[model samples]
Target: MTQPHLLYVAWGYPPCRGGGVYRALATANEFARSGWRVTVLTAGRDTFEQYTGTDPSLESQIDPSIDVVRVPFEWPAQDADIRTYSWLRAHLPQVWHRWRAALDTVTFPERGYGPWRAPLERAARRIQETDPVDLVLATANPYVTFAAADALFEEGVPYVLDYRDAWTLDVFSGVTLASHRSRVGRWEDRLIARAREIWFVNAPIRDWHADRYRVHADRMHVVANGWDPELLGGDEPGTETRGAAVSPMTVGDGDRSHPRFGYLGTMTRMVPLAALIDGWELAKRRGSLPPHATLSLAGYLGYFAVPDPEMLATIERGRAIGVSYDGPVPKQDVGDYYSRVDVLVLALGAGRYVTSGKVFEYLATGKPIVSVHDARSAATSVLDGHPLWTATESIDASAIAAALGRGWQLSQTADATQRDAARAYADRFRRDRQLAPRLRVLRDVATTPSESRG
Candidate 1:
């Protein structure tokens, strides 16, 4: 059979260093592995390398056979890289530029992504004229990717929208999205109605979108994030050598006494850092934790730049509560970091629809997980059956303290059989396994003549 042709639209791709890029790369590669000829349309390398911290290592995850097209992008006022700035911008006051950039985000639903609409629309039209595409898969954040897909749709090209996060609903605030009366809101509503299929990262998000767009529910699907085989399958300790620890006495060889609790991913305002600090303080006050228990956080703060004063204050407060900020850990070193942790802290914002991608990766580590989000969150649904997870009802310090104690207890006595079960549970969330069925559905949609033309 001739492989299906797909034009994938994403603002961040390999080398962009954003969290969503991992899923985009995995999705494109998996589709290619399943007999699809994929062409990825993304922002140019200059934007990725200079704006977002570039990681060439991520490219290794991309299938060399996949065709990727890089188009130029310029986010108004967000050019932190000195090289990208003109003489005027370079000389202009920093405060002035910052204000201009902030204004752009409010002007459109997607911060920094709105201005790229024209260029992206042109790119889509050019791609279609040069080579007819069987389908278009647009992953959103800037949500401007939807505009590009809409261009394709106008030209009778079928497209699917991958909503890594909802465009309309405020996931963190747990509020209804802007209604159709607003300009951007109307844009999203119309685009969604015309999409061939819509994929959300979790069920709650899928349900939310379904409830809003009831007639389009048949086209909506859920494709949760999962573990990458390359990142998960390896020696138990993975890449980290025993000598890498800061102190020898702090940890032991295959011993749980010196437990390291790690939190991996971005440290943003959305996270309940205040509650986390309180919980950490309670853990310290209990005096029951092992003397060597250390909570190490590994990730960036404040988008791509260093955190602001408020974020720094939160970090300082965490230090007061025995939580250490170790800065960002690259994706390549994630497995090594996981190996060092006896327990993982899944601290996140509360909402019925919000499920951060970290939960999937954390589950794959086979360590006891202490969830510091809402018990009713979508993440709980994924971790519910996993024996190693201890979820709390709220981010209250007392609740978190109790959960932390239980997690520590579990870590102290969890046998090899228990660890094996945890690992087995993670096995079910592999990237390929999570994405295969979704690809099949897209394939079916592409072949179905009635729905082939959006």
Candidate 2:
């Protein structure tokens, strides 16, 4: 049987260094493993390395047979590697560039990605001309990727949309997107309506789209994120032994005296860092936490090179309050960080629909989890049966404080039996296991009569 050719469009892929990239990489590899020839379309390596930073280790996980095409994307606002910008754009026309960046958000919800529509559409056309695609799966964040998919659809090609996060719904705010009636919203509605399938990360998000587009409910599917076994299996045991000596990275070195509690992902505005700080202070005030309990945060801030001043301020304040703001840890050292920490902190914004990718990794660690989000959060569904998790109903300082205390107690005394049970729970969420059924469905759909000619 010949494998079907699939064009996977994602703005971020391996080396892009974002949470969504993991899912995109895993999905592409999983499709390839299931006898599909996958070609990933993304921004060029230079742009990726200069703006978002790269993870060379992540490339090891990509299926060797899969083809990836990276096109040049110049987001002047996100270029930290000064060499990326021309002299006129860098020094002479800096004001105009900044103004244009500010206007981009108004043009489209995604700041840097909005202006990428033309380039992405051109790339899709070129790919189609070079190799006729059997199916196209476009992942969203720039949401503008849908524009490329729209082009393919117009050309009688079938496409699926993978919504790692919803565009119209503000998951953190738990509100219908204010721009739901705007031009972009209309585009999203039309795109999803025409696609073969629309993939969401959780049930709540799936339900939101289903309810909004009742006619397309049958097309909506849930494809949750899970731990990558290859990466986990290849990881070394100790966090301290894995990273560069002088690098601004810290991991949970399994030291009971100074046990590190790590949060390994991007530190965004949506994360309730204030509650984390309060909880740490409360643990100190109650004198219940271990003397050396320190929270190590390892990930980028803001979008790409832009740092959120408010979020940075909160991190600095957290440092004064006993939380160590260890800078971003590379993808290769993630497992070491997890191994060093006795407990993991899952701090997220309030939303029953927001089940962050980090939760799966936290579950995979087999360490006690301190969930600092609303109990009604979609993450609760995943951690509900897990034994070592202490989840709170609210993000209140006191509530988080209590949960932290319980998590601390769990860490201090969980037996091997309990730990093993936690590990068993995590085993259920391995990427291959969780995605197998969904991949099968996509494979079937790709070969179905309806998917052949749109």
Each prediction's total of clashing residue pairs, residues at least 3 apart in sequence or on different chains, is 0, 3
lDDT of 2 by residue, 1-454 (tens): 5578899999888888877889888888888877899999998878777777777778877888999998788775655566766766767776767776676766455667777887888999999999978789999776878888889888778899989878888887778874558776778878888998888999999998899889999988888898775565432212343321111112234465676677878888888887788878887677757666788877877656556778888878877556877777767677777777778889887878889898988887778998988787899999999989988667777777788888877887887788878877887676666678767877776677653444
Question: Per-residue lDDT of 1-454 in model 1, one digit per residue for the tens?
Answer: 5567899999899888788988898888888877888899999988876666666778877887898888899765665667866665678767656756676566455667777887888888898899888889999887889888888887778888998888778987778768878777788788888887899999888988888889889989888887675655442212243112111111114465577787898777888877877777787688656656778877877577545568668768777545788877767777778877878899887788878888888877778899999877888888988887887666798888788878888788777777778777776777777887877787876666645343
lDDT, each prediction:
0.78, 0.78
Predicted model with the maximum TM-score: 1
Model 1: CA > 4 A from native? 80-111, 234-252, 317-322, 448-454
Worst 10 residues of 2 by lDDT: 242-251
How well does each candidate superpose onto the true structure, as a TM-score? 0.88, 0.87
Candidate 2 runs further than 4 Å off: 79-111, 178-181, 234-257, 306-309, 449-454
